[model samples]
Target chain A: MKPVATIEGRAIPLGLKNLDTDVIIPAHWLKTITRDGLGKGAFETLRAEPGNILDDPEYAGAPILIAGDNFGCGSSREHAAWALADLGIAAVIAPSFSDIFSGNAFKNGILTVALPQEAVDRLLEVARDHPVTVDLDSQTVTTPFQDRFAFAIDPFRKHCLSEGLDEIGLTLASSAAIGAFERMEGRPWLVPSASPANVGLNGTIA
Target chain B: MASRPRTLYEKIWDAHVVERREDGTCLLYIDRHLVHEVTSPQAFEGLRVAGRRVRRPELTLAVPDHNVPTTARLGADGTPLPIADPESAAQLAALTRNTAEFGIPYIPATAPAQGIVHVVGPEQGFSLPGATVVCGDSHTAAHGGIGALAFGIGTSEVEHVLATQTLLLAGSKTMEVRVEGDLGPGITAKDLILHIIGRIGTAGGTGHVIEYRGRVFEEMSVEGRLTVCNMSIEGGARAGLIAPDETVFAWLEGRPMAPAGEAWDAALAWWRTLATDPGARFDKSVVIDAAEVEPTVTWGTSPEDVAGIGGHVPDPDSFADPAKQAAAAKSLAYMGLAPGTPLSDIPVENVFIGSCTNSRIEDLRAAAAVLDGRTKAPGVKWAIAVPGSGLVKRQAEAEGLDRIFTAAGFEWREPGCSACLAMNPDKVPAGERCASTSNRNFVGRQGPGARTHLMSPAMAAAAAVTGRLTDVRALMAS
Candidate 1:
């Protein structure tokens, strides 16, 4: 995951509030053990209707999405975030998001920008036609018509997004402390015990 | 005290900080990571791709729940687990394989410890006071009843925790929701939570860790408390918790996972100190009178779209908030309900008496008390009672709760998250209405176009016998 500073592209304006993870990716498609090829099932139910923006040729490969309040409301499934990423959505501008969904998106390198409802209303309108720009460095979303809407993300999330640090990378950054703790055996579970990998049922190394 | 006293959430959070970032974020340690079949496959795949092993395999537990059918038949050894649904079979198989490869402990379908992740976790005492717990399923908040700061995580976070045994999380604001007064008879924790969510609206607890306080929660059983905390997510809260108390400690005592003997004494001493300090500040506070909360039910899609059983369905146009008004209108349309209909008039074709929210032994006992000598209405196409886990199933059968339900014409089945969602064959068919104890009444939550009315187990049992959303409070009065 590389640092993402700005996403400038056609934005799919799905301004539907309370858009749950079930709608993002239904339960039926969750059977597959892999995260690949999920965008096809993303918004499956909503995409069944004619004239949905997800299938609209003009928004194909769009890198931005404008959503309404309470986006990603149901389920702790990361598949919702994966589907959005697979659809080439690099940034989501919404008034609010479910906390679990927000964390998932951050880990997967998708920028989630929280803006005021009025700002989102404007972005939803601007997203209908003109290209939009979300600049993480400035924490502002701009429209082709010069509409500049400032946004906010947790400063830590901003750092993680800009630094391309997932949880593992972040944890490994503190390897010295981890090593010290392991040496101290402060936590029993963290102790490195012999799991005896590649051993045989005959109770001896083969 | 020059400094402000911290809430229980802050106490637990500060205790778990492995590293604090310059950007107001921190790497908080997770004590336990619970995983389920539906949401963990991709995370395990991520670990395999990276050649990573679970950081602390002993601290992680995996189980299959969401996709297991309640009607599954016991099969001979070497035969499949009698799960005819291919999607479900695949998910369970994936979980089994992932746990095996990662050296993580798993409770398979036939295992005595197997059940819904939330129920089995607390039942096994893996959820303890003053610890941070995370699971891939949203109902993981149920673990909070045992006094842990618990919440659900996405698969990415699951992978993160699996690889590192920790998560980088931003701090959450604290909100204290203190309910005073004794609840009326038959007014369970479900009613109290529904009343609170109805008053606060769905997003009321957003960006906050809500601590359940006051007398109402203090008097609740662990199961009752879990039923309430389980739906904290539905009310848009990231996490919900109760301070560890004597009752919680007693429940955890002698369980398979709790500290023992001298260790238990030390743990209990530490847990007692985890309660909110006197004069602790909260970002927000709410007071609910237990007397006002009746047998509550959802008349629309959202859990917050609730009303007392004796109340009428609200007209969407009457809402002051435009967003709520729009959502209500849509909910009403999708639920095939109309404004001003007496909630009790809504007929139910199916009755589901399970889910992580209300599938504990007490919930079964409550429903059984209601259906003790009754039979299902002729109009009830089906009524089912699915316990929370295999252990729960065994316990219920031992107590004859299964017999009571079966005699009342309800199907008593194996443990799983049966009919909570449409992942398995248990579903409320299209265009049919169901009275469910499960959390969430979102459109098509049970199945495609299936209407769900969230209620208590007793209310669902009442619906099974009456074929309508009858008021359990009224039945008690009669």
Candidate 2:
């Protein structure tokens, strides 16, 4: 993970509501073991349509995406966020996000900013003709036309995004405390099937 | 006067928090990790790429469910279904190979008890009370029924748990839903949850983990409890839970994964103390009368756009908020439904009864019970019952439920999530409407351009028999 302060580029104005993870990356393309090559599959169906924003060279390789309400509305497949990142999307502007998707997006280093629909509609129009910028440090999405819309983010998440600290990194940072906690009386919860003692299902796996 | 006591959510959460940091994040020990074919391959790849080993392979379980075909068209010598698509086949193969390489216990598609990830974990006791569980699928919240603090995670988080056996999580707000009074005879857990979601829109449970308490949930069947918890994700909840009790213990007693003899007794003793204190406080609470709930169905794409089976699609003008009005109108238009149209008269071309939501034995029985003496309506094209697992299929056959479904013109087949999603070969065609018992009713979820109406198993069966969205309670009466 790498820290990111601001993303400045052309924005793909794909304001489609209820744009589920499946639409972002169809299930057929989820077969690959590696996250590589997912950008080609991102918005596979939409990319097929004529004049699709994903296909329009005007917004090619854009890092900011302006999406409609309820973006990432279905499935817990993190591939949706992964694919978006692979397509060079650093931030998504939506009215709201499904809880799971928002969590996934954050974990993947993609900023999700929720603004009112009117603000988003304005951004969609501005994004068409000029570049837009999302500054995580200031929590504002600004367009060259001086359209400034502020957003809210959890302070903790904002720190993580700026610090590039993933869960593993955070755990390593608190390794000393984790060691103390593990020294307590309780053992890690284990399945009987793999318990250290002589077990019924299998001879012993642990 | 000082304060209400800590809630069940707080107790379980406090017990699991290993280390709390000033940054509003904490490390929680995850007791179990459930993985399925669809979402885990990339996570495993990440592990291989990073040269890391599974921290606690024993605590992780994998299964192939979402992609395998439902019908049991085995090879000549009797083997697993010949996978139809290359993508689904590759996903399942990748899961099997990865689980074996990681030294995790994987319940394969051919395993008699193997089924949807959510159903297999609790029924097998891999998920237990007071434990923290996670899976890459949202419906893993279903495991919360057994009093575990279980919820969904993404592939990155899945890999995080695989490497550390712990998760860095932000605390969730707690809400309590109190449902009193007895449920009417014909009502089911599906109806109760749909009613709740309808009252509170899809985002109602955002950032909160809900504890479903009160007489209705306390006395509900274990299967019914699973059904209610299964759709908790649809409510946008981090998870939904019921306190552990004798019923849960009785259900877990002899399962293969449960502790035995002395261990079991010790586990039960601890479980008994896992209830919310009487004076426990919640950040938010809502009370509802279970008796007032009707046989419910979602008429549109979102779970919250629901109504009673006997009611009509809501008029967009009924919503005072402009955004809500636009959403309602869009949903109705996308569903090809007219405002003020009787929901009962909405013609159905397909009826699919299977999914993690309602594919267990109890669900099959409910649907079979409705189809016992009736045939599908003249207009219905395809109606099928795909069991959740190979064991569920065999049990249905043993009880002649398969014959009942077949006689009623329904295709009774082998188990693997079938019509709930289009990941496999079984899917409703474009421009058709399907009465489904799955948790989600998202557009094209059943297939491209296929409209899905979410409902309970009985409602699906009734739709098959009546060629429309007929109320299951009405059919039970007449």
Candidate 3:
């Protein structure tokens, strides 16, 4: 996890809504058995077009992507998130994101900032060659030019992100509570009585 | 105190609830979880960040599909090329690492158990009656073949279910879709679903749970039932389910995840009791005649906007509903289709049979049957059939289904979600029209400006050979 809450970097503007995961990384590139080379395939479609966002020399080394609303709307392909991270995109600012894609991004240590459409539009205009700062603690995204936009994240997600906690983390955090619940009146139904090796079953904690 | 008899839906719903909130929603426990390469990484990451072990790792199963390459090695020029695409590789790698870290059992690429998550779940007996199963994919509803309350969930929710084995859900109204009588020879499960979607507009089943009943559904095989329920979301239903029966039990017997010996016998007895009672009531009901259903195909973007094979396209002006008429007109304009033209005349540039929607062994067989000894349209750019799983791929090959497809000029590729969307290199060129067996036909679903005519696998095969939307019955008759 990144030690700092705010990440300030150059932005690459991609102004389009509903830009699905497929466009981020085409399915043909999924044959390999490693995540190491995924950066090469990220935004291949865009790169194919002349003067596209990734191919523009002016935006070289952009670490932030200011995009349109409803980004990453199709298939729960996490490679899209991996590709973005590998491509040096530390943060993504969009009007909204597919719930699955957002979770994938967060898990990969990439920040997803959901701003209003107007804010997204303004950022897209200034995103090119401009450095943007994102502060998770304040829940705000700002530009060097005095533009500051605050956003909201699910409290649960915020907690996980802050603590670097995942599903396993959540389960371990609540292990004691889970243990107590298993001992309640609904014990028989919640825990299998016959499966002795499985924990929470009958008098067995194995 | 008097208690009214509860519907099968209500009974299942109540049994799974661990807690109820003031809004009347229930925190229902998820009895089983299915995962796929496409959706598990983030969920696993959430688990890691939370420092949690899978609450019930044994309750969850994973498989690799979706992003795996199809053809062995053929570059854009069609020469023998090595199959190593970086994006899919990363996705697969992440899944392998994540599942291993979480102690989740997974069927990797080409493994006997590796297939579409929906297909593998039922085949392995992981999907059982009266259980609440959750997956990160929408087609999880296919598990309802066993009378289970199965549905798709978001990644965060996947994380939730992994940690607590419970889902927080809003209550939904119950709807019964009853179809009785016999389906004609040429008609299949795909046609029946298209007919239903035609009757009820795409959004008709919004905010409801669907129960499929009647003689037609009763006679359908487990796979057929799965096909019907798989598209419920396309019609706006939260899920579609069927009552469990002997066929369900027979299908589950002897599978990898199934109970054995005495346990199996007891499970069968319990499964039998999971069916709906005779007098159970629903919030709404619609009755349909199976005999009236014909081989149907979608003529436009939405599944509901479909017509029979030989039927002329609907005249937008004939629709009394202004909104529907307007939508029809828009669809027709975008599709470049003329009103009153026979659906059989719509030209197709390619044919694809794949996706979590309809890539089962039966679907492949149907396509093969249509393509037997037939040469495809001379100029058709592509005609391919992709099975949903490695198990399906092997079974199809064992039956020589691959030979029939290849002899007919179709490509028989490895199992994966290929060309369902324009994700893979298998995409149809922009502005081309295709006849596909996959479910969705939204605007540009196959590619930018690409027109998709959704049909059954056999129908897609017929179109591939004829270069147009021809009636599969005619081909069969010939």
Candidate 4:
């Protein structure tokens, strides 16, 4: 994970609603054992269109994306976030986001800013000509035209994003607490023995 | 002092809290972790790179499904054959090695237990009442049908759970979808969920855990409940839960991974209490009349772009919202649907009756019943029925459901996520329309340039026999 603070650049104005993970990166591109080189496949379908903004030279390598409501609405594919990162997008401005996609984006250090549709519409307009700025420290998206929009993000996620903290490392530090909870619950059935004997010949219970 | 009345979600969240931060996020404990080939390989690599061991290997189960072929996986000598696609084969192999390296129990691709991660979780009883289940795939919500708090996660979260057996998360707001009245005859859970999605658009359930309450859900079979919950993600809900009752307990009894004897009794006692309290409140509530739901199908790419089977294709200009109008126009163009054309008149070249959403034994039987004594229409070039799991396959075969489908001109195939996302070889050709039982109808979800119309298994079977989007009820009447 990389620390994300402030990003300033031209924004790709893909103001299409309900842009799902399939449009971000198709399932055919998911066969890779690794996460690198997904940029080539990012927006593979949409970019196929001759005039698609994702392929526009003006918005190439844009650090921000202005999208419509319900962005990343389907599939819990983290590849969507990875593909955006690969395409050099650091922040996405949408009216709303799918819960799973928002979480996945935060984990990958990509900032998701939820603004009103009005604000998103304005950004989509200004982004076509000028560079936009997103500052995590200020929790705002601003345009050179003196347009500023404030957003709210979970404080814990904010902390992780600014610090680029390893979430697994943070959770591991609370090992004692997790162990205690398990002991207190005392539900052995929750973690049944996975010995080979328990697995029947047909993979059912013996 | 009186205790606060808590909903089932609140109770589950409270019980699983390992520690809470001042910012309101908690280190939530995970009980079961299901892993499949596509989304898990990188997570395992991350663990290996960090020198991390699985905190509780016994609590995790791995299987390969997304990229596995529905065709035969063995040769005449009875040894497993190589996967046709190298990338897919490598992905599955990575899972096999990673699970073994981490001491996690993995059902081999050729094993009888191998299937979609969501289906295998409940079928093997790895998902149980009041347990917190996490999987790398979004359809993991299907396990919530059995009373587990389950949702999908990305690779990073998958690694987090594998290494720590806990997640850093905040509590989700609760939403109650209460359906009253008896569902009309011939209406299935799939239709009910599609209707719900239509009423409350795709993003309706965002940031909330929806609890399906009312007689409609309580009386639905466990398999049916799973079908409903499986598409919660399609509605933008991370998970959808149905309160467990005697139905779930009876369905879970004697399963391979379920508790036995005294443990079962202890589990049952706890499970019975895992329901919303009488005075509990929800952040949001939607009351629906079961009679209002009709056998529905999605006319556009989005799940919410749905109507009753008797309706016509909607004109985008009719949409009041400009954004929606644009979306509708795009969907219409991609789906090649003309406004004012009756939905029933839409022709389908292919029919697929399997996915994590609708590939269980019950779903297979429903489709088989519709296909019995009926053959595929001449225009329906291809039709296949892929069972959810090997167990489901064997069960269907024993009941002669496989024969019914094969005799009806639909190929009876092995279990895997065949044609669901077209990750395997069973892809609908580009520019072809398919009546599919899969959850999503997103553009190119079936294959590049492939158009999908989402429906129930019986409806898909009807489309196969008629070579068009025919209502299952009408077919049943005939």
Best-performing candidate as measured by TM-score: 4
Each candidate's root-mean-square deviation in Å?
3.7, 3.0, 7.9, 1.4
Candidate 1 — which pairs collide? B115-B389
Calculate each model's fnat, 2 decimals. 0.33, 0.33, 0.09, 0.52
DockQ of each: 0.34, 0.39, 0.09, 0.58
Candidate 4, position B320, lDDT? 93
What are the per-residue Cα lDDT tens digits for candidate 2 across B127-155?
88878889998888888888888899999
Report the lDDT tens digits of candidate 1 across residue range A19-48.
888888877777778888889989887898
Query: Model 1 - which docking category?
Result: acceptable
lDDT of 2: 0.83
Top-scoring candidate (DockQ): 4
The lDDT-based order of candidates, best leading, equals 4, 1, 2, 3
* Model 4: per-residue Cα lDDT over B1-478, one tens digit each: 1378999988888888889899888889999999899999889999999999999888888888999999998789989999989999999889888887888878888888778888888988888989999998888989989989999999999999999999988889898899999899899999999999998789999999999999988899999999999988888887999999999999988878888877788788888988999999999999889999888999999999999998999999999999999999999999998999999999999999999999999999999889989899999999999999988898999999999999989888878999989788999999999999999999999999999999999999999999999889988887
TM-score, candidate 1, first chain: 0.84
Candidate 2 residue-wise lDDT, A19-130, digit = tens: 7787787776666667777888888767877987888999888999988877886678888888998999999999989888998999889999999999999999998989
TM-scores across all candidates?
Answer: 0.95, 0.93, 0.74, 0.98
Best by lDDT: 4
lDDT (Cα, tens digit) per residue for candidate 3, span B415-455: 77778866556777777888999877766667766788999
Off by over 4 Å in 2: A44-58, A116-122, A145-150, A169-183, A186-206, B1-4
Candidate 4 chain B lowest-lDDT run of ten: B1-10
Chain B vs. true chain B: TM-score for each candidate? 0.98, 0.97, 0.94, 0.99
